[model samples]
Target: MTTFTDLNLCPELITTLKDLGYKQPTPVQAQAIPLVLAGHDLIAEAQTGTGKTASFALPMIDRLSRTPVEGEYHEIRGLILTPTRELAAQVGEHTLEYGRLLGMRVISIFGGVRFDNQIRKMKRGADILVATPGRLLDMLVQKKLSLAHLEMLVFDEADRMLDLGFIGEIRQLLAYMPEQRQTLLFSATLNDSVEVLADKLLREPKRVAIAARNSASQQVKQSVYAVDNGDKADVLSFLIHGGNWRQTLVFTRTKKRADQLTAELLEEGISAVAIHGDRTQRERTAALAAFTAGEVRVLVATDVAARGLDIDALPQVVNYDLPNQPEAYVHRIGRTGRAGQQGRAISLVAPDERRFLQDISALIGKPLQLQPVPILENGKLIEGGKLPEKKRNQSGKTRKGGANTKAASKAAKRAPLQPEEPVAPDTPGKRPSLFGR
Candidate 1:
């Protein structure tokens, strides 16, 4: 029964939310927004579509405007650090759109863009500054901006930052903030390092967990297929060709694979595009725009595009390769089944990934129905674990996008790697039908 108006938010912010057509706050928003509006440091665990952005953004904008202080030039009042440039840009855009009604200045800072432009913009100072750790550090060292005036610090994807080895750099950035700033750490799930960050950065923080551990969004229905690596593309093509599916998001493990897969899909008359770290800011933005606009029927990407993707009614997410980490499985699939719509997540697993698949199923505490692999044109099982002789023959040196195998040329390289982990399924001992030709 709690609505944005009932949360004791400022009238202006309430108006903004209403104008944006968000009449009710999400669970995270309803609970955390009140505490945040009270200037309390918070740790909120919510999935991608849970409106966590407004949970923090509305309150931050209100506090900056309602509470008057000696704001200075070239000093940011709030800092939100995310793990990737795409996320940073997104948060910045959201802040700008929502905070504009309040006449606020919001700026996004991340690497892969010109320093001159960011530096020029930073001179005037900003109310909300969204950034990536690396670029923030670079700007800090260059004396482009100072954080001494910052009143709020948010780690949007703390666990991701840890996985990306930014703790050291985060430590460096933390040293520059005032000891008495409000902190908000939001992520899909918390690992040990994130716990450490909350313990160290927050002061008497209120912890709000909207999602349970190892649980993917309920909005998404997940399934898997145990097939040989050779048949992944064929299976994907079949799924698209056979079903009423309109938009599908496919995840690969590396940038190189993303590019190659996109080309492969195009060759098969399927419109596809790939996004990764190697892509320029413009390229990534264009690809995402095209996908959102339905110009691209399928999107092939690495983990870089997995997190912080805010697509609505995405419908389908194909784990062309399962993620090595179980948590990533949650985020990748979360792209679909968003905003309370039904969505499907499908994983293609090879024989070698059986144990890994089991691990993930165990972690989620449910059995992922295994779709039997359809018969390929050839009367074989489709190289479940090994690379197609064609892929190997095409590049005996191995595809640059495959999993890291340089360390062990002796392990008998398989067709790149299909990701996996060993966790129990939510449904107990449920044996799914394994499909094969």
Candidate 2:
């Protein structure tokens, strides 16, 4: 029953939280805010949507606001490093929202945009700076900013930073900042690499774990459909169309796959867009805005591009391509089922991806039962049979096909849907009927 007021947050932040309609402190915020306010280096493991941003942002703002700056020029007292531009933007927005009443100045800088604007903003000064490691390092090398007076350092989504191979950049950035600052590392999961980073960055850190490490949210109902790799797009399309889903987030392992899936969905008369690393900041922002506003029916994104998406009440998420890193599965599905709302997480598993599925299941400590694919029959949707098993060679290894062969290339270009036999009626109390009738 603890509230933001009980957390001992400053009155300005408490009022801001009230105006934002946040009635209570989430587990992470309730536990980590006090330590942050007290100037303790912290390592917090909380899943996405658990208010981790506010946990650090509120206290950091309160601490910074205690002594107001004398002039229009504000020194960067707090630095938050995120893995992706989207994340940096998100954290920056939240920090601004929480600190606005206190006259705090916050700036977010990342790549894929004009550097001069960021430089100008930095010259104006920021009490708190949110940045991606690469852009932050670039600014340092260009002498656009200084962290010499930094009082707090935060690595938001620290695990994701490592996953995106930002560890070296992070280390390099650290060398530019003061070593006496209070460091805070917030990650969804604490693996060995994250543990090492925490060890190196934090000094006698206070630890807070609001959820089990590497676990998917219990509010998300997870299901997997076994199909051939070539049939993934059709299956995803079927689910979206049949279920009449207005909003869905789909994840692919590669940027190429994301684009391909988006094209296929668009061809199916579904409004779809692809977001990935190659896209400019403007393009990514537009795509996300369209998706959030429900102008886009499906948003196909690679894992890296989808990192800081904060969609409210997202009903469905599909794993168009399972991630090789099992921890990423948790992050992908975490996009949905946020704030205790029910959500559906569907995965299209091909024969070659069974190992990935197994790894994901093991990491999440639960078995993901494969379900029958849904198919169209007489223009009605029905459950289809399980996928056929892969043939084995004399060596007992699964036989492989040449994916680049002319026949394979021709098959890839064919219409995404293929004929399938209807197996059984839609079971009651499972997923809702696909027909949306």
Off by over 4 Å in 2: 375-437
- Best TM-score among the predictions, by candidate number: 2
Model 1, residue 297: C-alpha shift (Å): 0.6
> For model 1, what is the error of residue 334's alpha carbon versus the real structure, in angstroms, after optimal superposition?
0.9
CA shift of 206, model 1, Å: 0.4
What TM-score does structure 2 among the candidates reach?
0.88
Clashes of each: 18, 0
The positional error of residue 390 in candidate 2, measured at the CA in angstroms, is: 9.6
RMSD of each predicted structure? 10.4, 10.5
Best prediction by lDDT: 2
Query: Candidate 1: global Cα-lDDT?
Result: 0.75
Predicted candidate 1 versus true structure: per-residue lDDT over 1-437, tens digit per residue: 88888988888877887888986878888889889888899998888887888878888888888754455553578889998888888889998888877778899998888989888888778888999998999888887788988899889978777767677687789888899899998977887667777888889999899889768888886767655665566557656754646799998866666777788678768898988877888888899999999998998888865568778789999988777677788888878887788998888876666666777888788887455432232322221233444542221123233421222222233364344343212112322221110
Of candidate 1, the 10-residue stretch with the lowest lDDT total is 428-437
